[model samples]
Target: MARSSRSSAPEPTQGRFRRILGKTITYGLILALLVALGVAVAVAAAVRNLPSFEELRRSPTAQTIRLRDVNGTVIVSIGPNYGRWLKVSETPAVMRDAMVAVEDRRFRYHFGVDPIGLARSVKVAFERRGTGRRLQGASTISQQLARNVFLSNNYSMARKAREAILAMALEWKFSKDEILELYLNKVYFGGGSYGVDAASRTFFGHGAEELSLSEAAIIAGLVKAPSRYSPTADAQAAVGRANVVLDVMVDAGVITPAQRASAAPAEVRLASEPNQNSARYFTDWAIPQLDALIDESVEPLDVWTTLDLDMQRTATASIQSNTPEGAQAALVALDRDGAVRAMVGGRDYVSSNYNRATKAERQPGSAWKLFVYMAALESGYKVDDEVVDEPVTINGWTPRNSNGRFSGTIDLRTAFAYSVNTVAAKLGDSIGYSTVANMARRFGITSELNTQPSMVLGTADVRVIDLTAAFAAVSAGGKSIQPYGITKVSTAEGRTLYERAPPPQNILVDAWVAAGITDLLQTAVNTGTGRAAQIGRPVAGKTGTTSSNKDGWFLGFSSGLTTGVWMGRDDARPVTGLQGGAAPARAFADFMRVAVANRPVEEFTTQVELPQWQLESDEEAYYGDPSLEAQFVDENGQPIELDPAQPGPQPRDTPGDGPGPDTADKPRLDRRWIDEVTGSGGDNGNRATGQRGSGQGGP
Candidate 1:
């Protein structure tokens, strides 16, 4: 009886224990369901803002403006330069296999988020918790694409949830091949490049369609850390990373061990590093102008610029070699039609991208006098007419010459050649400062002019490009021009988008006025402050030096090129003994000597013959003397009377007199060899047309 009772008691105890176990199981199941529901809600909330499939598919890639020289050589790329967009069928089998093996071994089986990879990554994190190693991520190719394209790389649970949700959405909306294509086409490579084709071109000098197995492996390995494995950054590290990719490919059964062995040596040959980055100054200036031509809907563009690569190199070297220490120098050279051929913004673009050539506004000093002299010439003043160089005052502002003591009563040519401030001030005052400012505007000087008497002495700030264009107009025999850099803009497939229109041959000044100013410029270069700029040719130029030598400038035209150089401290601090005739003129001569070596020497137009005027009486009339009137004689020495009411020797050619036939013969550069080498069928791969502007270097 006692044994039976003990057994019954144990049965009841066992039954009680079973009831407690059942309750524990029910609570655990309820808690697990609630947690799962919470997680589902959080994921749903995180992904509510996700982009739709069509929006994601149509997401814009970083479009680049690839700048090319006149000869079709690439100058530089602006923005993240992407290569050709490729499809899965177009991708090489070897490249695909290598990329899959290295980036995501289970890329084919993953439904978007790879649970196996996540589990393994978790195990590793726990194993190395105290090792001070960075926690690794197990992002599938789809997850990576989602993060790269749609999500930021914030390390948070919400980001991870969104990434996973987006990955799944991508898998649902796109086929595996489409996902792979997007990933390969959108992946980031180093050196401001993106995508397989761009990366291949950047690293191997070819496209992804032609990638070798080893090259494919090398590029595939860059996904881990692009900068770390970039061949340009470190060749040895790149080789090691590529070998690792080959080993992974072998393990994944994509490539055999034999194939891996052959590619293990990583006999990868990288393309030569681009040495044309020195042209960034030109690219920087030309890129903003590109937006005005094409809209965002257009494909990536190949911009054919007006730059002469050889001339650009020479200008850069000359500027770098001639620029003074602790000071910056900028140079802008234009063709006769005002096409920018060469520009150097500063001593070193790496140190500063300030773009002094196009952006810096510095006082042009005597270079500003080009307008004053043109005004004088347009007002019927002869180049040989006499002007007193004594100190002059206008509007209670007294102006002194740079030498502080000017020669008494010198011819206009002598006064101009010497850059005498007193004569320039007097000329501006007599012609009405407004007239001088208007003259500058007519010649394409876009900067605001002070219109004060000091403006005649170049107190106004101006861009080097504008000043250079102004000089180019004078060299073009008074035809106005707008400075331009791009000649053609087209897509990679050779569809032309924007082509620079031929410059209008608008006559800004009379031919006689241009000739008279040219005569003065020639005298300056021959026997005056700009004598150092003599390049053994008939050069016509002017020199400008601001007060205390804060700014120096040399502007001139020769061999059908108008170039301007400016040298000064960026802070406007004075540079010791920095006159326009010193470094700026020497640099101009140095650059021009080589830039125009092949071109035939061209001479300035003949100076217009003017009647000998009575200088004393003319001066009296210029000073507003009502009693005495100026007298003039014809070239035949016949006495003539001047009209006080009517100014200037003759009326300027009206707009109806279309360009007046002083146009020089435009020379087109022969690009037969360039076509043969580029296989561009004479269009330079961008279908560029109409040659470079009208005169000197072109095509």
Candidate 2:
């Protein structure tokens, strides 16, 4: 075949100039071909070295988190399933719709990266005349998965080039399902939780198995901008995102206009507090225990605990809401097996790592009476046994009641429930200070209990954590269990890293004897100083308001949990009108109500009472109501043994409603903040220590 008309017609112009021009054209064409080949080779090589794009294409970008009720019913979460996270595989229809709606419309048609999208983005940037080009990312699910799972925060051109290469590699390495799983596991949804697994539980309070369309939409929308679109952070933005996602789903033909219209913007329900079940409070108090348990050289352990999420929520809430002003609070919640489910050391965990629940010693005041009575019980004393509630003195320490007037004569139970200082002192004196201290230690009192008479009234300082251990013994039916935080811990790839068992010890008191004390604690709730704490259930607890009213405490227990609360000011300048049973109780009650709302109601395991006694002494003869007896006995109503104790949970009944347990302790560390070191009682936050010229509140 003769050349086409155009090829033949262009051969005319001749001579040396034509020959040189022809030669140059031929050379230019060759050079162009070579350049194109090089570009192709380089791009191909880069893609080959990158992630496996095919694996990423099938990776999951959208996931659901579900929070559930105790009965395993989904309550809330990021997506529709409530408290569950559903992988794309679990709900492909939703995932496909989400992918097409928000990401690449031609995902299946493209190899991980989309050159057409990039070119279009370049065109838009040129038109806009901006140096920094906005993204019109056409990365398929596979490419996104690759970047999310294994990429850097670097946004330079080099990083982008690397990301593209990695994307290809990921596609090659993982099957669609595997890539999707990695994608789902790596993306963030804000609210401080990492991974889809953690996000689901954090937002919806459930696992990955449950989710609804609405919930899924909410979570899926978070992928583009997790923090800004998070339901917890901006409900309006999240709703806007949900609407956009719905529209996209409809456009993609995944859902009909009617379905899109029917999709409602979900209401986000989030825990008021963050970082529950991390054992912030207990970590401080249990430091020694933890150090003893694990080797320190390799960062000790990456551990997990059997903490109940709901229970921990309540603990933090209680402390945050109820802690007295200027005070820092701390708390720990434990299972009967001695696992610390939740802990809060102070008001703001980020401000300081000091765990008030486990660190920072504070006076127990009347709260310590529980130990005195426990000591009395161990010595074979009956709760109803007569004790002179008169002037009690020891050396220079003359312990007196706030009222400075005693009830003349009272039973051990009566005094304990009332937190009568004089009576507690007498009981401790009779029991021997050494014996009482030893008993306290057995119940988990890690702090040194003073041997002085004032120690009987809880005068010696005790950390809230130490108090928790002592109380846990009471709840565990007299078994002395060491408190443990982690149950089991695993690596991101599911490799087991650590595990924990409950702290173990023998029975500190007879079952009946322990029950007897719990019984009296119930009375404290029914008609003692802790009456303010009663909330329509059998709550065995104690209310301790320090003499200065600076420190307030309410330590309580239920069949499901044991909680200790302390309220005081960071400056130690009394919380003014606030006290233990209020802020702590309110916060505690808030958490407990939600935590156990779906669970069956449970009761304490104590049951024993004392017979009404008629004292021969006139002072004893008029010991209140004869029918109102005191004593810790077995089911048969007799003192099992003189008791020993963890006085953390003393039930008190009084005239007024007050705080509940799980309260925050005073921010003792706050006062000493090196960043802003100062004295106590001054607004400027710096003053002379002894001049009484208003000093700084604390550091």
Candidate 3:
């Protein structure tokens, strides 16, 4: 009876074990079903936010804004580096092998996520628990592309789940090759480069299709740590990473042992450094104009500019070489039609982005004399007219020459060539300051001008580009010019975005007046303060030196080109002994030498004749008496005809009033005597011949 009871107890124990096993199996199945359902719901939610496959494929990447020179050579790329899109078939086989071997060996077999890799990563995480180190990522190529394109790089469980779900969607929608192609084109390779194409061009100076086996391995190795493995930043580490990629490729059977060995020691001739945008100043000045002309919706534009790269380089070198140490300088070169050829805003663009050429406004000094002299000529004054250069006062404002010594009576040509301040002031007062300011404005001087006598010597401030364009107008034969840099803008597909038409040539100044100024300016370059700017050609220019030498300028033009240069301390402090005739003029000459080396030497047009009626009208209109024209008559006193057909006198041998061959046979007149008697020069004692020195001097 006891044996029977023991056997029965064993049966009950077996029954209990069977019940426990059944419950355990039921709970396990329920847990598995719950996890699978949760995964399905998560995937569906993630997929709901994803874009359509076609939309994702058609989405535009960040395109580069390329600025090309007149010759279509790319001078600057202003946006992200997105190289030309390439297909998976277009990529080199070796690059594919290297990438797969190093980044994801199971890429070809996985459906977005690799179960084995994920399990291994989990095991590694468990083993490395409490080590305070991040666990390695187990993302496949599709998963990486999903993260790069659709998800942020956040180390959160939600982000990872979304990445996994999106990766699966990508796999379900595309083939392995398509996923690989997308992955290769979307990865960041650091240094502002995006995708394999840009990375190839940036690091190897070639295309992805042109990469060698070793080069392919090296670039592939950068997937893990691009900045850390940059060949440019650290060559040895890059080589070491490439070796690891080669070993992996060999183990993966993508390359043989001998091939790996051959590729391991292969020389990686990295491409040369990318062309830096050295013409940053010109680009900065030109971009605003470009933007204004083109619609904002038009993107990825190829801006064709008027920049002459050779001239731009020459201008940069000249400014750096001629500018005094610790002083800043700017230069702008323009064609006769006001197309900007070259511009250098400062000595070093990397150190400072202040574009002085278009933004900086400095006193032009004697460079402003061009407008004053133009006004005088338009008012019936001739180059040979003798004016009193002695000390004079206008409304209690005494004006003196730069040398602090006065010439008794100097011809208009001599006075201008020497940049005589007193002569300019007296002429400005006689012709009317309003007329001078109007002439200046007509010549494109946009800055406000004070009506004071000192304005004749350039007390007002003007931008270098405006001054350059003003001189360009003179070079273009009295036509108005709007300085422009971009000639045309188009898209990559040859679609015309913006085409710049030649602006109308509005005649601002009279042709005869412009010619007269040009003649006097030729003499200025021939023997005056602008002699340093002579380039063995017919150059017309002026030298301007401001008070305390704070601002120096050389505004000049040839028959076909015009250029202006300014030099000063950026802080507006004095540049010690610096003068326009010294540094600015030399820089102008140096830049012009290179700018016109390949062009023909064109002479200026013949001086135009000022009509008799025009001269009579100006004389009567300005002096308020037609008979006053006789006061400026020649020695014979026959109401000397001011003929533009006749050539002016040669430049004076000396700077001041001295005996020289007078071409016009004009008589010396103390214009101050006329001013005092007519109440024109100003309300002060205007001595025709006196040396009184007690006042603040002019520039």
Candidate 4:
């Protein structure tokens, strides 16, 4: 009975131990299941808040607008938001290797996130949490791309979890090369540059495929902190970063130790600074037109413009060197077809954005004489016809020559060459002011013209561009011109958005009229007021100085090109000693000297024949008229006969009371010519004309 009792007690103790062990195992399993469930819930929640992978894949990237010169050299870039897009095939292997070495050394072996790197980051975070130091991120290339494209850069557990989930999704959807390509294009480099392509061009002045090992390393180092690592900003730090990348590349067996060493000390030749070209005036002028050419739905464009950068430099230098103190200058050059080649809007575009070439409306002064003379030629008036330069008055306003001394009875050609004020005024009054205004309009003068007689003297304001275009008509043999700059616009993918075709030729002036005027202007440039503007070529130009010397103008053209230069104070105050024949003419000459150096010299076409009337004397043509006493007038406002027998000034016949001269015997003038001479040809010899100076006279 005692053996039975001891055995039964041992069995009870054994049963209790077994039961306690079983309960302990059960509770442990329950706790493990709960923790696993909680982790799954957190991960699921993070995934739900992340952007959809398909949406991110389909999103459009911002683009840049590149403007190129006529020679296809990039002058400036407009929008640099996402920079230029480059495919994976376009990226050089060395550049890609450098990026991987610096950014994610284990990028090839890692799934999406580097678990070993994350572990180290976690340990470091805990150590530095209380030390006021920033915690390092453990993002692989895929993780970085996921965050950059589909998630914010917010540092939080939730954001980190979302990044991991999106990274894994990207790994599942794309190849390693695809992920790397997207990461490179989406990454931001400093200086308003994004993507490997843009960054390569911005730093090396070359494409990504042309990047040297040293350049690749430097560019790769910039990924960590673009502005901070930018060589332009901090060369020493950027080089240090590049050396670290080179060592990593060596460690990864991507490059030899010798290559790393060679690359580490290589000098980084960064690209030249942008906006160094003097094309801002043209770019600013073209901005509005560029915008109009592109549609909103189209991607960013590449515009090819008609700017000759070399000529632009020449134009800018000429204007800057010749502009006088306290004065501003503007210039515009156009090809024969009216392509704006070079334009300098002011002395310095930085100091002032006011484009004088296209904007300013100042009096053209005697440059306006081109239209008046054109009117006379069209009116059957000969350039060599006699016109008295003596002082004249009409309705109490007297006109005087620039020298303040009249050279009586000068030919129209000599009068125009010297900018003789009295002759031009009398011609305007005789032909009527309306005739001169109409001629100006016919020649592309868009400015409003005052009907007063002074309008012929260029008292009316006009734009420099319009005046330049009008001169282009004579250079182009009477064809009207509209100045244009852009030639073509296309997307980066080579899709044509706009292309300019040759504009139709529109004739604005008669060929004979243009030829006649071109001849007279050539004489002016060769032997007259515009003599300073001669470029050792057959150039035709006119010189003008406004009242008080407020504005000086030189409008000239060659057979190949036309250019206009204007010098004046912006405030319209007079510039002392400034004349169109001086600085303005010299500026024109300097610019043309460089512009035409490479072009073949050509002479002006002489297409017009001299009129028979111009070849004969007035005495032989009208000597035998019965009413010669009523037909001709002298300087004293008295009728005179062709014969000396009736030379004494005779009283005028009563109005319409006598038989007029036989029409056949009289050398009949066109009614327009008759009215012109009969109304204003007679001179008032005793009138006092106004003060005048060199090159300061009527057109």
Candidate 5:
């Protein structure tokens, strides 16, 4: 009775204090809870307000492609190893079912976040993962899409939270089927693949539509961790994953136990070489062209160019088979309009990133004589004009012929056809270095030409594209053209932001002048240094070699196509005893034969102004390396003339210099750079007077 009385009879001040303390504690707890709730809401709102999946997926560096042969065979898939996508219109039911069973058992029923799958995944995570991957993921198809398309390849709670929010948003915006499709299409299933369709064909000989249950299950198993369970990477691991998936499906009652037992792993037919790219180099080059012409917003555009599949295959085969064992080769083909049809960057592109055909800048050797002779021919010098091939000195440098024994007197055509370097240098001198440089520019050899007299002998580091365009110009009646790959670029709905259509150009050279030039080129293959480049068809072309046997090149053309081939190491190392006519010429012949195999045979005829095989000066003058006199010009050396009266069908204007954004200062490379560069002989033995707009090798 005393204890009850004491409890009830608390002093008024003490009781008031106790009551106030209790109320204050409760209020503080409530405030803290309210603040936490508000903070969580703010974070959810921020995540929801972030960029959408499509916006986050944009990348300027992602190489987009639309590659097709002339006959419309998609010889290569289009992408540069990141953020790739492909379609699957009709896929294997077994594959689809396996995906549903393995990735999300109730995929057909869920909105985006599968509550039951997430619960199951969470339950399994606490179980650990050593004995064949027990730890599971709450990632549904939508969550996986959020991760693959938007987030980076990282594992974190923050990332997972973002994935959950985005997945929810995606489910709200898109159908469940659409979410599944995007996830399947966007996922990368290891071994240089993206999308279920690409993965199916890569792992199995069949498409996604033809995948067996085992195959489908195997692919689905890759979803958890593609590299860890790559069938090609580790068959045992892949089998283990498949078994685990089968067990899970059976346990979940998605499949019968007998069906699970019946499922067996099939042989995964991997590519011969993991990096076996059918057209690696070609595809690499093609991506840049597409990106340059089209905007990122464009989609579903298939670019059909002049690529010849047969020719490309044949060229690759020839280079792979006939090269000097470890030596590499690249090949390129172009039509009259300078549209590249087929481009093999190397013997095997996947194994090597070296683009021998397009990126290499090799000394053209005698192949450069084409421009020198073109300059001479246009400078009123005839192909039959006599020139001295004997030891000639220019600017204190003596130039020797490739054979080391020069004919005392030979016609300019004979000298060029024979690949005589000294005589070609002399003609460059006699015709003025500006004339030769100018001719090279017009021919589209925009790689900086050297002002040295020996530059006429093809010492410049020009690419295969340059050679193709220059040769194509000769075949195109001397109409200047830039090589084009994409024919047209438009969206799936046919909205055209960029349509690849090159403006036509008139003849840059007289018909007779070009005919005479090609006449010599034909002779170069028929009875001269380029005899190795001869094909079954009537062809005209030239072979090029570089100093120290470092680079070998063959540039040739028939009426139907102009092609170029190069062979060398990526480090620019010398292939001693190798010449252009040996490997490169053979590659060119093989590629051209396949490229033009189906084309109607055509011939070069008189197209524009006729030529007058003018005479040469009868002066006993030095050709190379004497008095430092790099260039000698005829009286009338000037820029090419355009006939206003005989206007062409279309006039392709040069990239006009406008009120452009302020350009950065481009530092000049000094003249004696040859001595400092450690890559040439006595400053390249070059000393030609440079002309404006020639892109000549020197400052």
Candidate 6:
């Protein structure tokens, strides 16, 4: 065929081949250069945003709130725990080699990224592409450190470029040991632990410097998947993973086969689980109180609390042993100055974080009688004052004793000993509910109270801590106290940041009243309902059982320690055969039996003398004049209002206008009832002993 003028004659085959080859080489080189330029620009952009090498080398450690007991023993750490930063030289050689062997054998030679490993991974992925196998990541230790410290795991080309650039920068500015040290201290291990030292301490119950070969291997294996390989989560899987790490160590020539064979599964012993729940409830309660003491925002604190670790252990054991199955119990014990010595908020803190002692507000039941008797005593009523404990109804609400019967015309001390609800109700009706509530407030009862007659029978909901603190006041010889836990707060370097000052010693009740109430509580524990709490020593306490057996409580003091215990279901469901004297009282006894063993025995004392007593006719004594409405007056005998600083429900606009028990059917008082109610009385028991540090007048 003839060639057209526009087309040249058929070119030589050799010429055509050479022309194609030249064009191919030229175009390929141009594309390659363009790609290289783009990569260089991306690298430059990433490297420019990175922080200085000095800043990167610091390896910031996460701070956490650490709590210590009175003995300075660690109670708990509230956040991710980071031990002291460990240098590469400080880390055991076995641990270092294991990490390098399993994570990146080429770590010693690679500048930052391992191209040969990446190529190998890519080849393997391509070979298994149709087999549903995923692409393996060839990121070296440096790349991991870069991503973890300065970048995010975004899985984008830009992020990879930044990570690679940052890794290179780390290598360029720091030595190989410094880079490894930063990585070792910055990587997160399992179980809320950060850094290699923390991991070693957590897993091996020792420091990173003390790690053995097997333990080191196990810890190194956790870097890939912490939760999956955590020894605490799966010991067998972790040991298997550690065996794989040993194999890699052997292949990398970091360890000989004979050495690997010696590191058996049995040699990989994990540390026993820590006492995390030992006092978790107490720490939870003490955490919020930090905001008031220090600038927690500036740095973490090491709170030196008032918790007696031994007593706390005993209290937890007592509650766990005595509390009925399917029910929960809370206990709070305080020193004379209101320092919380030991506290257990529930049966199991993990199963339920609800702090029953500090948070739950349930009826105090007969334990409410502490305020009733205290108010009556402060109002001039004696422990020996005669009161009728009969089937009495006021405002249509009849306060029945737990025994369903009464002692009928019993002394106040006797009735209190047996926890007579009828006598408490009559006192509430005669003294006025507001007076009782104010008395509770004076003693630091900071719960909302119902000022009705039933409230006198312990019908108001109150926190265990508040009620315990109130009783602590009586135990402190009428000196009111604010319950506290944290004694001092300091920084990690032992710099005192905040220390608790001595709480104000505000007198809540009269010494005579305190002595009188002590007499009543002594009677209750010695020969009455609280008998179960008797530790064969001088113990005085009260027992309370709510309606339908919904709640049970025992509060008392002995040898300068006051404690309160409450037992019931969280749902407020009735527990059959449950009563304050049975479970709570026994728990108190079991706890006190050990808690106060070292404390010296102190006999209770009184300064006031009781007047001559006589029983009156049922007509005149049982039914007081209906015209006389109950009144509460201050020291001047004038009417008073509720103190706003105290935590309690304000009285109704009409003080005695609530749905209280009818007065007509209640006790009949003498003409001098108001004036005579304030008469002081003597304690029937030993009344000449000294109080704590007084050598006279024991509470």
Backbone clash pairs for candidate 4 read none
lDDT of 3: 0.78
lDDT (0 to 1) per candidate: 0.78, 0.59, 0.78, 0.77, 0.66, 0.78
In candidate 4, residue 462 scores what lDDT? 92
lDDT tens readout by residue for model 3, 18-73: 99999999999999999989877767676677677567656654445788998899
Off by over 4 Å in 4: 1-63, 80-277, 296-298, 610-699
RMSD of 6: 18.0
**Which model is ahead, 1 or 6, in terms of TM-score?**
1
RMSD of each: 21.0, 23.9, 20.0, 21.8, 19.1, 18.0
Q: What does candidate 4's lDDT look like per residue over 1-699, in tens digits? A: 999887788887889999999998998898998976875565566556644544544554444678888999987887654545667788888888989987888888887889988898889989878886655758999988876665555567787777777776666667788788788887767666767888888878877778888888888989888756787655777888888888889998899988877774348777665444458778767856865665432277788998988999999999999988999999999999989999988887655546789889999989989999888887877655678878788767787767677777666767777788888888888888999999889878888887887788899999998999999988888898889989999988899989999889888777777877886788778767888898988899999899888999999898589999999998899997568989999999999999998899898864455454543446546654334322444333333344446743344342322355433233323332343333332321111122222342333
Candidate 5 local lDDT, residue 190: 63
Error of 4 at 255 (Å): 64
Question: Which candidate, 4 or 6, has the higher lDDT?
Answer: 6
Model 4, CA-based lDDT: 0.77
Residue 592 lDDT, candidate 1, scale 0-100 = 96
Worst 10 residues of 6 by lDDT: 690-699
Off by over 4 Å in 2: 1-304, 501-505, 608-699
Residues 424-494 of candidate 2 have per-residue lDDT tens digits of 76777777898878877877777766687667766678887778777778877788867665455333344
What local lDDT does model 6 show for residue 621? 39
- Residue 477 CA displacement from its true place in model 1, Å: 0.8
User: Which residue runs does candidate 3 get wrong by more than 4 Å?
Assistant: 1-62, 81-277, 296-299, 614-699
Evaluate model 2: give its lDDT: 0.59
TM-scores of the candidates in the order shown = 0.56, 0.47, 0.56, 0.55, 0.54, 0.55
State residue 654's C-alpha deviation in candidate 3, in Å: 36
- Model 5 quality (TM-score): 0.54
TM-score of 2: 0.47
